[model samples]
Target: MTRIFSALVIGLIFGAGIALSGMANPAKVLNFFDVAGSWDPSLAFVMGGALVVTAIGYTFVLKRKAPVFDRLFHLPTRRDIDRPLLAGSAVFGIGWGITGFCPGGAIPALGLGYSDAWVFVGSMVAGIALARLARHTMAARAAGKAV
Candidate 1:
């Protein structure tokens, strides 16, 4: 229950940050990709600032044995570049390029009363469901083969 509340509070802070940053505007994000026409470098600055802050946070957080809310520090174990990773990255890049609404930004953009965010979020949810189903089917096949 505490963990859930902490997550909710953190998520709200993240959403508020996104909203305040003007990143909730798809046009602002899309313009960052348009190097030939009306390119905006503000996104790059924002990314750099985030990177700096994250680096500082990581420096402090990693020094701790465990997280404040959790007993263990949850981190990615996989380091190797695999087919699934590459495919997922490509898909993510394509989606971002086309829609300019990332999962993080899209959630906050919902508060702006834009139908575009709704469509993107709905599609994202469908994609996530399909991915989970496919992964489950693949795992079942692998297990059956092993038997």
Candidate 2:
């Protein structure tokens, strides 16, 4: 119950930050992407602010032996830059360029009840499902060959 409450509070704070920073506005994001048109560079400052805060938070977290809630930090052990990572990143970039809505911004934009936001969210979900299915099929094929 405490963990759930903490998570809810964190999510609310994050959403409020996104909203207050104007990141929830699709037009702002689209304008940022439109370097050839009336481009807006405000998002760059928002991203930089986020990066600085994240860096400070991570620095403090790493200094602790254990997290306040979790038993361990459970950080990713894999550091290799492989094919799947590259392919996925490329696909994500293409989608972002076409839609101007990354998953985080998409959800908030959808909350504003825009038809385009709904369409983007639907396509984003479909892409995620397709990626998961492809990964599952590849794993199954690998297992079958090993048997």
User: How accurate locally, in lDDT, is each candidate?
Assistant: 0.91, 0.84
What candidate 1 gets wrong by more than 4 Å, as runs, is 145-147
> Which has the greatest TM-score?
1
Put down candidate 1 lDDT per residue, 16-117, tens digits, no spaces. Answer: 888888888999999999999999998898889889999999999999999998799999998999999999999988998899999989999998786899
- Report RMSD for candidate 1: 2.1
Query: Candidate 2 on 5-97: residue-level lDDT in tens?
Result: 998898777777777878877788878999999899999999999999999999999999998898988999999999999998998888777
TM-score of 1: 0.92
On lDDT, the candidate that comes out on top is: 1
How do the predictions measure up, each by TM-score?
0.92, 0.90
